[model samples]
Target: MIWNLSICFMSFIFLFLTSIFLMFLGVVFIFYDLCYFIEWELLMLNSSSIVMTLIFDWMSLIFMGFVLFISSLIILYSDEYMHGDFNIDRFIILVLMFVLSMMFLIISPNLISILLGWDGLGLVSYCLVIYYQNVKSYNAGMLTALSNRVGDVALLMAIAWMLNFGSWNYIYYVSVFNDSFEMRVIGMLVLLAAMTKSAQVPFSSWLPAAMAAPTPVSALVHSSTLVTAGVYLLIRFNSIICDNCLGQFLLLFSGLTMFMAGLGANFEYDLKKIIALSTLSQLGLMMSILSMGYAKLAYFHLLTHALFKALLFMCAGSIIHNMKNSQDIRYMGNLVLHMPLTSICFNVSNLALCGMPFLAGFYSKDLILEVVSLSYLNMFSFFLYFFSTGLTVCYSLRLVYYSMTGDFNCLSFHPLHDEGWIMLGGMLILMVMAVFGGSLLSWILFPSPIIISLPMSLKLLALFVSLIGGFLGYELSKFSLSYDLQSLRYYLTVSFLGSMWFMPMISTYGVNYYPLIVGLKYYKVFDQGWSEDFGGQKIYNSSVEYSQYMQWWQDNDLKIYLISFMFWIIILFMFMVI
Candidate 1:
């Protein structure tokens, strides 16, 4: 008990202090737009400057505060949740490192400095994901690491390409960069980096697979910090990206990602995995909206979603802990009767996730839908946004029905007390935010409410989607439940949704298959066969033959030397006569 509690207690105190300091910074930056660059000119070439630079601005300070606040709560929650673990200290260290890496990412305005935080995030997250000594954790860590490395490579390329500008600092150039070809390339690469980090579209498989990590990692990684890194990059680069053709493509793909994740959540049965997919879906929402030239709104949603979603993960974690690590929803039901507080927190977060009235998600989500409705978007994007909204409601309700209501589904009963106040303590604070954070942020972010001129029918569209989705979710899960979903007629459709439209296969095998085969072929042909036969083996045989000939000539050294000398003399005399 002391082992676990002491780490959490110390971490919470440090983080709490850090959060307060960052909050003070955020307030200062917000009022004054604090912008400064500390430059160390290590070396200067004829036309370029290489320097270490750090930027302080409202975005960095505010984001840093939010990150510290959430991280502190998560660390505190892990005291009870991670109790009795053999390597709890290692977990605590990784979590703190995760927080530090994120702070680096938030503060840097230079691409080179950003990579420091970016790569740290990838490496630390991979370590945390594989913290458990299990095959599943190992595979998940590899997938997570490799998927993120694609982004790291992209960022490095962007950094190299940005050398044309002679400065690593990009904040100054964002407004005008879109006019140049090189900058456009950087923008596209930046978008790619963000997509992989946020698990947008084809890169989405790793987010759910990452659920193999401990839930505290999931709360921080998925809900707020790691996944949001890409969105933050896009938010910073919005000026350049929003004007590019790639931004339009981002809109299309992000919509697809949102719809895909929402649909996948509906078919998913694993409780933690379902919530992981929900996080993926919301990431799509943020990215797609950012692509539509609403970067601030997207950022606003990012903040509120982080609050509620972290709480959501904590609630789910508590349930899993109480259930002795059974994540299958089929084994859960009527949890509210036993774990009332957790159930309340879970329901509140779920409602907020669905954008229910006055909740944290409602503020940002409702605004997004309204603004998206008024924006001049294509049909595909419009449909995806609205339909995906409903799917969010559908999955939230389905999760509620299967796991929070109905009879006790588990074969054996355990004490369902919300006895872990250490875990619940963190959740309680987040719950307050989940209930009111949206309204508070909305007031601060948008001093005056945004007004949209839409017809009555269009204004009600969001409400309609939520109602229909909620009803369908309840009916399908309760009254009209059928076990024949695996019948011949329904099997294919069920399998498609169940498998997340086969995205896992496409992402895992589709991306890796050809490269792996090419690697094997190279190994066989060059390393084992052709290189040895034509290069090393041939050279060795020639050397052996020459050595043998030299040995034989040496055996008859006097005669051989005399004959060779006479032939050379005759040739030289003939040439002189000619």
Candidate 2:
């Protein structure tokens, strides 16, 4: 017992030290990149000698910095939030494990290492989700694990297919698979995995369930780590996907997920769940950009989203913590007055999420919209973007309004204050990034001196649509619009018809459905008759019959064994002669 305790203590110390070390390394790397940004040759030469070549890229650096920054903040936040709580040590260990896995993931050279890191993250996240050991938390963790498993299987199949085709390395895979039919299939499979991981479309139900985790875990995993894996995957394989039908499919699916999830966020009341759904929506937008072959825009969105979303989630956590575990936004109001610093940080991040002009999200989102406009695809994508942007505005404002603007009704038992200097320190850093990350990144990547301009007409249109959506949502909230809408019914009907229309094609080319049908029929038969009817009859009938048979077999056992041995000897001799 003493040895085990010592080992645990040592692990905690190691993690705490590593967190600080990586954070320092990350800041230094960022500064290094910034200095080298002015001279491309120097940057390239320096990168060549770096221990991890994969982490040398500007995109990797950006994401790594975000990861380190937020993770360090989370560690500090956990110190206060989890103080004196049972399992605090274990929680810190898991947090360290999660951060280490993400760092490895950011710098992994190939798919194998990436998968290891990815799966490690999934495991740690599951642990954190069920850290409290409550039934609800357990169920949520199970569902998340199952969903991630499906994605993992898809990823494994894609990796195997790539290796079989002699494209094992990341760069080689992209170059070789650009024009191959097998590559297209592999890309689609990867996209499926990405979709599930990012909580897109029909696979999105697990994200809200994941809210059962502790607030810090929710903030860290949902925003900066787990959900972003799919976006990272999409960005990593953008070249191969862009050259295939998978790109178009991704565009459609991503746009659809964004629109749908934004709507869901608009309707959700749980603060953490709202942020969870928003993460899904924002990730969908990022994926759509990647699908369009705009790798720079996608990475920019990833960086900016990480900053703003993490801040927003952490701020939400502070509010919930102050409210004594109440996450319902209805119970929260006038927090702007009570927690002034937090309110500013939260509102700034919220505006950034709303794509307000000159903020981080605006730059990234506008770039994507611009690229989408230039794409040769159908107009449906454009329409989806327009509608999604409006919905994004509505949900983003919903968060601000419900938590910061409404009347203060809930009585405070304890005086509310902003979280400690350590937590606020993290939020302040993110706030700075939320203000400037996009502009700095764009300057680094875009060749020639590109002017940073927020077009007045575009701003006006976005703001007008946003205000309309927000106002409408506010008005609608006054009434319980609980009745099922005809539009939703139509959506379901069309979706069913679409599935039916594709069934014949799937049956002919995809996996065989005959065996599945047969198995279902057999299961129904057994469930209805054999098990049910036999259980209702004498329960000992089969046992008695089997016992009698066993006694008869025992009487003849010696004779049977002798005959079987003789038959085996003769067969063995015959086979040898042949």
Q: Which segments of candidate 2 are over 4 A away from where they belong?
A: 1-55, 412-414, 450-460, 477-524, 527-578
Displacement of the residue 421 alpha carbon in candidate 1, Å: 1.5
What range of 10 consecutive residues in model 2 has the weakest lDDT sum?
34-43
The residue pairs in collision within model 2 are none
lDDT of 1 by residue, 229-316 (tens): 9999999999887886988999988998999999888888899999999998899999999998899999899999999999999998
lDDT of 2 by residue, 124-169 (tens): 9899999888998997898788778888898788888877665444
Clashing pairs in 1: none
Query: Could you tell me the TM-score of candidate 2?
Result: 0.77
- Candidate models: Cα lDDT each: 0.89, 0.74
Per TM-score, the best of the predicted structures is 1
Error of 2 at 189 (Å): 2.1
Prediction-by-prediction clash tally: 0, 0
Best-fitting candidate, scored by lDDT: 1
Which segments of candidate 1 are over 4 A away from where they belong? 1-4, 32-34, 38-50, 479-491, 513-578
